[model samples]
Target chain A: MEQSMKPDGMEPRTSSLLDWFTSTIGRILISLFVPFVTFIVLWQGFLFLRDSEAPKLVIALVAIVWGVGGVAILYVVSNWLIEQLPSQWVRRLQPFVFVGPAVAILAWYLAIPTIRTFWISLFNADSSQFVGIQNYLDIFTKRFMIEAFRNNLLWMVIGTSFSVSLGLLIAVLADRSKFESIGKSLIFLPMAISFVGAGIIWNFIYEVRQAGDPQIGLLNAIWVGLGGQPQAWTALLQPWNNLFLILIMVWLQTGYGMVLFSAAIKGIPGELLEAARVDGANEIQIFFKIMIPYIMGTIITVSTTMVIFTLKIFDVVLVMTGGQFGTEVIATQFYRQYFSNRNFGLGSAIAVVLLIAVIPVMVYNLRQFSKQETF
Target chain B: MDKKIGSAKRQSRIRDFIVNGALLLICLIWTIPTLGLLVSSFRSRDDIATSGWWTIFPHREWVMTEKIVPPPADQQDRDQPMTFAGVTGTFEELREGVEQDGKRVVWIGNKRLGTVEVQEYKWITNANFTLENYENVLSGKRYQIVQGDGSVKEEQGDDLSGAFLNSLTVTIPATVIPILIAAFAAYGFAWMKFPGRKILFTLVVALLVVPLQIALVPILRDYVKLDLNGTFLAIWLAHTGFGLPLATYLLYNYISSLPRDILESAFIDGASHFTIFHSLILPLSVPALASFAIFQFLWVWNDYLVALIFVGSKPNVQVLTMRLADMVGSRGADWHLLTAGAFVSMILPLTVFFSLQRYFVRGMMAGSVKG
Candidate 1:
């Protein structure tokens, strides 16, 4: 036993078969038994709770206790099981107890599903027959797909640029202003609102009424007040309606950009800006040269996030316009194809296209992350 | 020298004015949309439909028609006070209620002898604000239609309250599970020595950008196969899976940056990783944990698509966002209910944001900029 513990500097020591239960490999294998049973028990409990006709309040209470307590018990029991093994095996098996569930979940949820989606994209509708490249061909040549691509591009360009730039502008202006916190809070307020809520909120702003009716919608009221025809901003406008939809995202996301840029701006050493100013840099010059370049990392990070977000924009479009009037983005297209048309193949293909479009940004982000090596 | 100093001070003053003005304008633009909804939620149905929410001020006169059945002659005194609906007033006051208090009050009802008419009385009044929208929305009673027999039937509303509870049921476990799981994984990535650590960690990082849409179809199929669709468990697991990557990424950054000496010293004291994590690392990571908790809480609480796909708009299980989305789709003309419902869904996230804003902002900064 003593020799087994001294593997730190000693060669491998043989043990009896009975003693094998306490050996490193033996304990590692034994550690799996407890968690496996616990998982089965919890799964059964979850299934029971799901199918049970109990009162909702009772179910909810039981679930909260069971779900949360179940995870806690799982960890404690598994850790206890590992600790009962020889000290040498404890070290070998502990990491699994820590990282195993997360890795398993991520693989099941994201990594594996992504590959599955690609495979499904290669098949026909209902996934019965293989139709390689046919779905992709439709995505490229179909009118709706083309509209979605164009709108997504517009969202990527206009939405990202507006959110980031407006955020940067506000961050700069409110850097040390007395109203800095207030302004930032107001802008960031929308970020807390669900996209569905924001869609409705903006719907009030974009609502159109009959020509003689009182314009309850603020935008229409303003338009009619200015002697223009009361227009259906989200339905009638061709390309501009897309901008109207994009505005909700910009409104929701600008605060995100602002908060990040503000933090990054504050990170700029005061002495650097003071030095630049002392050397006779004007405000615009200081902004362009020192401020922009100083927070350029943050700018890129925010821009990349905004770009990715805009690419996947769905809820606002789904709620506000239902992808009508030239507001069809890739995500809404995927929704229509998969859920509405029941064309899983085309939906999967459209989703894959979206994923492909985002790959460059993801790769660039990875490079930036690795370069910083913040971890 | 005096002139130079004076001009510099004036230029600085002008700059301050411009900055303040610009920020004020921007904040106004940002807040007006939400403010419009907030105001509209308090106005009566006719007011919301006929006039803008902005007209709530200036004490707009509303034509409120109430069908009043005159009280029996025995119950018309000040003690009993004639009452219709919820309004109570003496017979004399109710008959000729021309003006009371500062608001102009006018009651139009035909009085025969000492009794008020049983017909409808339209009150031209200045009391514009009403809590009926919130009441109706929260209570799930859309309208009360008077039948030909004079019986009132209360139609069911969107049941936002039930959905609100369901949202809580989904959000709490979803938020808590991911944080706990991610925290452990983060500790492993931060401190543990293991094979494939680098590759596994990079895999998690790459997953941060995987659009959740890609997982929907397969997962939906799997849920159908497993008979997990429309269950709280289904949506909870879906959210956990969707939220794990960022949770791990954020927690890893925070846990990895913890002072190495503390963990090293704990290890030297014969503390196992589990013990050290529970006793020391967990306490030290509160700020990180809090930020990520808020992040996950808000994300899961405000989620629509995941809940919609997994939970399936079954009224009993639908979350607030789904119910609100459904209302917007079906009740396009019911801005009164829509505005109130939208506010109901927003209440929790807004409260979390306003109160825990520091941690929330820190989380966002770490989530985006630190990456």
Candidate 2:
């Protein structure tokens, strides 16, 4: 076989496709070209199979093949292609090969839509005409949107403060206790629950039955047991019902705050607290003067995170009140405008408002992160 | 000096007790809401509607009364037997015999004739609990079936099992696709020499906080145009897109911080970038990948908005969160079903939470603290 190949190399008449592919540029082109074509073909086939009116078993088979087999093929082909390139070319192109798909998807999905939302915010309700800032003005002047802003403000102030303060208090108290893990775990348990689930749980707690019916809601039951009327807590509480909704968020977030603050507090040198004590400072004084100052950065981080979360709050409000009884926030308001009312322009405006509200917090968070990285 | 130290010690001890008590109370307050729902899910509908979940422990008693009207004077004692409420039984026999009967009887206790010629019977009964709600919810039938034998049996409500499967179907691909895509991208950002790397990475980190609400309208419109609306593929793509920012950001952070020597050695051994990623980076990055996987899994599982929009509320495709929320909306008064449904939806996340709690917490910390 070697002697026959040598003779073919000398004559060039019997040069084969395999020998051509083994050439450097040929190898590079084949490695790059074959994988991409194969990927496209496989993807198209998968999409076709997915949309076909096939039997359940057949569809399932296609799904398995696409999920497992398709990924494996793509990986193998891409690796083979990368291997064929020169070291310098490979070094330069490898990152793009790896990261390009993610970047393309993100650009198509998030970045492009964000720009479109900004553009759509300038139009009318149906987005067929450019209304130009009318929707934005309505967001400020409309009663429900104003109420949503008010509710959001309440959540920001009350939710952030309560979560941070309670978290700090728990961290300090449970820091060295025997039951610290148990207590923290119980408090942290709500973090594991989705906001929707948390809303349902709290709804059960705030449930109200008519007079003479047994109070299924624990809150109302207790209220009635204390000789008070069984009020529909979410509806009848008015502005304060906003606090009730915020309470659910605080419940879920305080654990997160506690965990981060606890780590920070533990990082605080014991000598500082002891020094404060020696200087005749009491526990409260020490906490305010020493511990709080020390963990201020963490407090800001947690608070800003909660603020961003509060601004975009949706699931809990939607689940609990459906934005009825004046409990609307920016997120739920956007949802109603977009999905329920089908007001694309107004929804886009509301979404832009939410984006504007979040940017500062995110910027601040990023700055803090960069600052910490430097340290 | 000794006296001063002794008083300080006493004060500190008191303070410790107070602190412990406060934490204990707060913990109870935090956990009771969930505890109520859990207890209610297992309770009979009547029990749940009639009493608080906390009342399950105590023996509760209530007086139940049934009215039995006697025959008028014209029909009385003329060889005409008196019947109570259309049942052909003497009042004495009815009152005494109904207690021994298995069927629900209106008259089951002592009866007395009133001035209006109506007889009333009353009895005391204790509160009872049952697993009927779970049976109904899990089976997906909401109505009670009265058998030929005159006993009531509960049929299931709308099949939560089907919705559970739908949720798994949506969640698995949504979770898996993003992680795989993000892992490759993260590898590029972290180790590979790429142009505009810093700018792209910063863009991803910045996009991390972009409210998903902003993406909904335009994406939905596009989906409509592309005829991708309400398809599983639409949701899978949307979730992957929404999830990519965080996934890429997190995996990049973890992957970039990986020890450089191992990767360098792999590169030196004539291993290609993909080979090095497959053999070294992936296995070495499992901890990070596991953490991100858990995060994405929980996020997608608990997600309602994306699913609601992309998938719509079509029963065949509705995820658990959507189904649970729908139940709450349509059957608001059915606490038994609502409580059971809430728990059913929560079951998977809670199980994942408890089992991989360490990774979940680590993920949360990595996400927030680092960001």
Candidate 3:
């Protein structure tokens, strides 16, 4: 009691309720709430419009216009109005108004879907009624979904590994080289092409030509010319085809890795490199001993990023094999379940599975950005 | 000073060689696929069907082929040396096929004449070459040859003349609307004293985590209810929705890094928020705005998912991506034509990237590192 009283009638100077509400904690609430409220009203509005004489298509188009338009107006007005206040007050509350519309939209679009998807996972494919964990259980029990899950593991382990390693190697090799810019640009060029486009490009390279049909596809024609019967590379089934798909991701993601890691590699002090040379270390030794440690943070950053990206990869599998022929990744699988199969629960469950798989890496990545690694 | 500079310059030349050589190699690799795509796009389906681009050099040569109609086999290989007049014999021919094996003819004039027959007859001019594939693709016959799948063959736009305009309609406004709004917001956030600025920024950043798929259904429901489901307007709104988070995030990062003093002085000098935004913020943020513009423009341009949901896949309304996908999904197998069609779709994106790419200022990364 005496100790408490001596502290000027305050309780150990914990954050004030007002301050708590105004700061980090309260703002996150805005992140969560604004999107929710916006969505509920939009859904309700859509329902209300259901009875109107308006055509369903036109009604939806208008609501979409309004939702999007409202977000734009809110973004401009709130930000401008907030800027008028004093700095200290603005600093405390500015983030809310500035980001509120965006967060609301994100929620309206992403957050609500996320929550509904989670709920949908508990329901049947049509999302009409509840089904509980049966959909999730089906992931393990069903043959096709299981194979898809297995393929996703392959994507996560192999695709991420190759992308990270290749990217890192390219980043290191390209850095400070005479052709660094050219090498990097070349490596980066694949990224400029869409995954869909890349699929089309590679399709030609991997194209098969039947005996009479002059092989339009370079790959199959080359194969046939080399004395092997032409084979559809994408239809090669598992093991090999999986590697084929992974190659595409590596081709695309290597550029991303190189950009991030190259910057990190540059961040290493020139002094350390000089010291390694003075110590009679060979170039290889210096790279492994001195250089690797210096860029380890960057490497971690890059690898974790690749891991997250690998987890979310949908387009590659979708375009390449349509997630069939043993190339199904988790994200593609989610789309397959939800839309193609019309099974919302399974799709949501798949989404959840991916989200769960990525959380650890996401946390780890965010941590690396903030927490300095010890030498 | 001159001597030191000269020595350094000479040393740098050696380094330049290595750099330039490497860059050249990189550029070659980058360009090769694009080159492949472009060349592939123009190639005849028959040419594509038979050989690789590497063969183009040899394939381009005119192979003079001399030939005569042989008697029906029922009439028997006309016995005895049927003269140039009776045998309807044809002379030797040059060709691009691998069967020629450097010089050996796979299908020479009648066997009765043998090697000597080469001198016997005249060549049919320009008989082997064709632009039929190009015509077919442009004329839309490419669907049968390039896309094997009857159900899924991508319909080449009735020159897609209308869809092209529709795509532009969806893309430009989608891009413009977001950039305009984001510019204003960015200036306000950077210069004005707003309540909850930090928190608002943090929330916006957090929005990055919310995946788009989650909102697809609900958004559709909302759109349908609002009677906006099947128009360019819906696509515009959808593009803006998806584009805003990234646009604001990027613009905010750029604007916040502007010299605070310049903005402050303007504020004190009786400049309204609008005035400061118009005069100073807008002028200086060219790089940021350009980069975001590139992003928004390219995204709205290439986006498939939003267009698919809002506009539906009706032939008249479909975009290039959908059409191309139809070509692939249906053809079970027509890669050559697919490559060509893909190139057409890629042209706009590539041009956009190249022309506006200068705006992707490296200094933005400088801010990311520091801030």
Candidate 4:
């Protein structure tokens, strides 16, 4: 083994693989870097293509040159810089290549749009006049808007937990079963239906009929057949209607949760399961004691996804009842204020509130994702 | 020992059957409503009103009351002695001969026409049952139904040409535009490198939190400024913008996951990033691109809000969901018509989904979940 080393007494094979990632490929990129950057780098590249009324040829040229240069140059620069630095820096440096595009998009779209939204929230309806913090104050003061806040909280708690728990339960039960494929597909079918499509379908189910007349809505129809009065399902003025709306979210999201949970379950090591079985543990014990703890990170991930989804609940409410009858959620309230009322101040305040509610969940998810990517 | 092992095998077999059976039942329960809706969408609204979707299988009775009017002698059918309910008469006596081919005659219930002679067999399904609704719809009889407090107002809804054109306007570009933007971005994100990459990724991932509703007001305001509001362009842009994050994210995962060795070798072969992207990346990403295209296409097809806001309530600018909304509201009580409208709207999405859904699943989590 010692004789296999170079005359310089260094590991020649290790050096070459390092050399492949660095110099040979690195030189082409470094040489191409100038031409690439000069050609590709431009102002607001995506938006420019969008705004250009120019012919397709011009747009194509512009986009290609800019993109090619940026990618090739960045690769060369990042690789060359990493080679120059100590080995300790390489691990930390690799994430940039993966994450760079997402950051630029966020800066242009989200960061700018969000800050602008906040600024507009401070202004009047058309975004012309300044009205500092007044919109925020109005949300706290207004009754319907306050109800919207409460309803959002309810959606967040009930929707996220239900989607996660039921999904987990079903996933655990369905794992390795003969019907697993069918069971998951049936549930997952809802995931494909857009919020608007699902709402339209549900409309028939929740459709109400006159007491003596035949029931048309599947749900109310069933209720009537079972001898109950055909109640206006969404017209219930109490907490019941909110739960009914929440059920739509649960129905739509349970499939998403199930998919995630099934993946998590599949990820559990077979040896651990075998070890638990060998200990004479029953099926329930093996699952709860061994499997659940092992996939806890995945459980957190699925729930966090639910949290983000619930925080932005909109379409079901908009389509079903226009968020009327006390089913007003944050997103619906935002739409109604901004679009319907054209009350920019109030709308921005609601958006700000929603943004605030979502940040912690996002931070937690990012941390978890980065944690996984590293370890 | 042999007996115990055999007994254990028998017990496990029993457990398997019980477990499998329970799972099938659970799947059935979850799927029943969608199945019911699909069935109901195909059913006549009256049938939906009258019975459960499950009732479609059995013998069922429908109470139908229709009026009859005798046709001019020139309009009379030459086939046979048209008698209804054992009452034989001419144009002077019998009150039914269905209106066909611009000739007016009343429809007798097929069951009633068969047993109860209306003096002629002129009125029945197909020739009369249809084209009348289309005629009525074309003539703006859509606004004819005014039930309770008149909560829904009809705004000169789609006459055939109008609705058909409106639907085309909304769907075509809404589908085409997003794929264009998403493909480019997905390629760039997947293959290109830049600064602040992961954080930007985190941001886009975080954007999954930004609901479409959150941006509606602001985006609409921008569109209004650009004078693009109420144009097909606005709706197209809205759908494209909203659909891109996921499209790019999904495509990035897939494109990035392509064997780096392949891309590096292509680079060595003097393949420009564009050539590599257009040829190798695009071809391989067909599955991912197909799935996202299906998703965005279906999403744009089914989207109601972006259509409503960007396209406005103009009758000619409406998409299917908006038109369906209008149709459902105007013909609110006529579920048969509503079901028809729903099925019409659902047709494209379902066709697109069944054809491309495998891709939606694969493209969605391709890089995220390592097999």
Highest-lDDT candidate? 1
TM-score of each: 0.85, 0.85, 0.73, 0.70
Error of 1 at B258 (Å): 1.5
Compared with the true structure, what per-residue lDDT tens digits does model 1 show for residues A1-375? 000111121224566775654675666666777778888989888887867888777777777777777877888998889676666687788789999999998998889989999999999989999999999999999998889889989999999999999999999889958999988999999989999999999998888899978899999999998999999888875887888888999999999989888988899999999998999999999999998998898898788888888888888999998887788889889989999899999999988887887788668757866786544
Model 4 regions more than 4 Å off = A1-109, A125-129, A225-227, A365-375, B1-3, B6-10, B59-208, B366-371
Write candidate 3's Cα lDDT for B55-155 as tens digits: 65433432435443445545544443233322322233211111222222323444544322122222322223444444444443334333444444445
**In candidate 4 chain A, what residue range of length 10 has the lowest lDDT sum?**
A1-10
Clashing pairs in 2: B140-B156, B140-B157, B140-B158, B141-B156, B141-B157, B142-B156, B142-B157
* lDDT of each candidate versus the true structure: 0.82, 0.77, 0.62, 0.63
Off by over 4 Å in 1: A1-44, A368-375, B59-127, B141-154, B369-371
Model 3: residues >4 Å from true position, as ranges? A1-100, A211-213, A361-375, B1-31, B59-158, B180-199, B331-336, B361-371
Cα deviation at B367, candidate 2, in Å, is 3.3
- Among these predicted structures, which one has the highest DockQ? 1
User: What's the true lDDT of residue A56 in model 3?
Assistant: 36
Candidate 4 lDDT over residue span A264-295, tens digit each: 88988998899888889988898789888988
Steric overlap count per candidate: 0, 7, 51, 27
Better of 1 and 3 by lDDT: 1
lDDT of 2 at A276: 84
Q: Model 2 in CAPRI terms: which quality?
A: acceptable
- RMSD in angstroms, all models? 8.8, 7.9, 10.4, 11.6
DockQ of each: 0.37, 0.33, 0.18, 0.16
* All candidates in order of TM-score, best leading: 1, 2, 3, 4
